[model samples]
Target: MGGEYELNFSCMLKPYKRVLLKLSGEALMGNLGYGIDPGVVEGIAGEIAEVVALGVQVAVVVGGGNIFRGVKASASGMDRATADYIGMIATVMNSLTLQDSLERNGVQTRVQTAIAMQEVAEPYIRRRAIRHLEKGRVVIFGAGSGNPFFTTDTTAALRAAEIDAEVIFKATKVDGVYDADPQLNPNAKRYQSLTYGHVLAQDLRVMDSTAIALCKENNIPILVFDLTVRGNIRRAVIGESIGTLVGGFCEVS
Candidate 1:
């Protein structure tokens, strides 16, 4: 809120270049039931600003659970594909809002959607998106891989692999992946680092199995960290040894 306040939170220590940040839809909610909270949006933009200032090229993939969930609606009898399309639109709205917020802070951003929406945003082009990143423009990929039955998590992995991101940073409520849900189980053990095999064997829900498999096959690493804590994004990047690193322990041939 204040100069010193933001200064203290950012630039603590970390220099990063090129990272993928995954934000949940609920992150846009600030002590409220639903919708985008201005304070929450600004706070997150601050987090992005902090890292972008560190000479890092940032890309984001935001979720749509805040407004509506097509999957949940479909369970109530709506067609699954239709429900998913609705969910995809919801993500586009969230992406637009995020783009506006980031640009307000003088952070250059671009919104590329998988679904064709020429009037609103650019269509997803892997080479173009990579160029945007190289040019230091934060690119936000929206529309959930433009396919039904897939999730933003999977889309994040797909994009990360396409862009050659060193690691995918998943910002969650909990700081790191745990053996069990820490909230429900007080004795849950937090894993500082986890292998993809261990996660698959243990059935950890950090990311959907499909997403994990895609990243595993692509040899991309995943870093799960807490976005609730300010500047944690930057901390998790720059190889800070924060959160859980899953898969790709050995480089793929």
Candidate 2:
């Protein structure tokens, strides 16, 4: 039995060697209404560890919606730039928490922030981040481009391009991109595949326009999948076709 397990494991082939995982801060919330949930974070870390064991270079871009949402704050009367900066800081916090969970799972990780926070994390250095991934360490990117008015989605696309990742796995609550909100529309259709032009034209909201544009320009495919489903990360890395794929092709099912 042990021999068979080892043989099968060794024969497993992943589709992409290097990839970026975009995780929303809300994912860490799990069943909670706010804040990070330890159980949820640990579960995600375990799955990431499994993928890393497969020799895939992983980079993560985490959002800060759970702790703080800049957009909402701004709409409530706060200065837009100030709210966004606070949101960026919130992302750093989430990144550190994720790094801790990942390390506890025996996966080496580095937290790099766009804003200067050398005391807690390394500054975002593209070459250094790539080098860490090459060395089998997971690199977590925090802060949204170190600028205001940009979502973490854009940061993921930007960082993925900088690190030369082959694909971007966007882990979301929904399983895939839908023509309408599945939560609201019972007949909402999920897209199996999509093209950059279609996504841009239809404004599917898979990611922000800036993010989609960046991915399109860099030719990096973005796979939108449900993070709540355990093992989905590994499934994505192995090309199991569990999500909506956005790239140069278009298909619907």
Best by lDDT: 2
Q: On a 0 to 100 scale, what is the lDDT of residue 11 in model 2?
A: 23
**What's the CA RMSD of model 2 in angstroms?**
7.4
Query: What digit string (tens of lDDT, one per residue) describes model 1 on residues 34-104?
Result: 98898888888878887888778889998999988887999999999999998889899999998998999
**How does candidate 1 score on lDDT?**
0.82
Predicted candidate 2 versus true structure: per-residue lDDT over 33-144, tens digit per residue: 9999999999999999999999999999999999999999999999999999999999999999999999999999999998999899999998899899999999999998
Pairs of residues clashing in candidate 1: none
TM-score of each: 0.91, 0.92
Residue 69 CA displacement from its true place in model 2, Å: 0.8
Q: Which candidate leads the pack in TM-score?
A: 2
Specify the poorest-scoring 10-residue window by lDDT in model 2: 1-10
Clashes of each: 0, 0
